[model samples]
Target: MKYTTMEQLLLTELVGAQVINHGGIKVCLRRSENIPSMGGATFDHVALFVLDGTVVEWIDHLNPWDIKSITSLKGSETNLYGSRGAYGTVLIETK
Candidate 1:
């Protein structure tokens, strides 16, 4: 559960963000935006969960707001997510 310096740097970008590091994994509290089709609705601050290690949905129904959480991924990290990660990704643990 150890994050590399690079990871730490990424997390730092999200100033004023609440980051919970659990075994290398990083989860930040982020605010969710409204989905146009959903009638411009908004939800409470959601969790942007980042999975640990070298890698990285209902997510479709959710309209993600500005990624005010951790910093956006770059280079290889971005490649891991493809177009979906074009902006950034939040790893969530289901189960």
Candidate 2:
């Protein structure tokens, strides 16, 4: 999974974050705000997983304090099942 410069730009602008290339993907570590449903009422750091050219999920539920993981699949078919992006997908979890 390779993250393009354009994709990195989009991510930084969308989330005000920086990218770390790791495990064939761009990882973003961000600190977010309160989330009631997750038993989180304060700011906390979360991991953003991103796979370049892959599909991402759980976009709607992404918050400031959420940790996200993104990955891209090479030579793979698009699931298009529950993802939110055309290029790739993300997994959001509490830190």
Candidate 3:
């Protein structure tokens, strides 16, 4: 839920939502923007966490449309994970 100033700016200023790459190393400012393939990686590839604490690599493969409902965590929000969360994290709650 916490984000850096830049991350917040991207979310508010961008015309569309943002997405992260497979390795969680890059952030796409707009939904239409394409993130290059990371060798078999799925689209919207960020660290995915469910309510149960299970983590997933990419949400696109599971269900492309599901990305819309995910809550993206970036910057300082990822501090808890140290290096693994350097890029960012995504939390998805399944109903």
Among the numbered candidates, top TM-score falls to 3
Q: What value of lDDT does candidate 3 attain over all alpha carbons?
A: 0.45
Residues 1-95, candidate 3: write the lDDT tens digits.
43343334334433344433334423443233354533444445334343224655433334332233456666788787676665456555544
In angstroms, the error of model 2 at 37 is 28
> 1 or 2: which has the higher lDDT?
1
Pairs of colliding residues, candidate 3 = none
Per-model TM-score on C-alpha atoms: 0.27, 0.23, 0.41
Error of 2 at 53 (Å): 13
Weakest 10 consecutive residues, lDDT, candidate 2? 35-44
How many collisions per candidate? 3, 21, 0
Candidate 1, lDDT over the whole model: 0.38
Cα lDDT, model 2, residue 16: 45
Put down candidate 1 lDDT per residue, 12-69, tens digits, no spaces: 6545443333334333333334312232233333233354332332222211232223
Q: Once superposed on the true structure, which residue ranges of model 3 sit more than 4 Å away at CA?
A: 1-52, 61-69
TM-score: model 1 vs. ground truth: 0.27
Model 3 lDDT-worst window of ten: 59-68
* Candidate 3 or 2, higher TM-score: 3
User: Which stretches of model 2 miss by more than 4 angstroms?
Assistant: 1-7, 32-95
Ranking by lDDT: 3, 1, 2
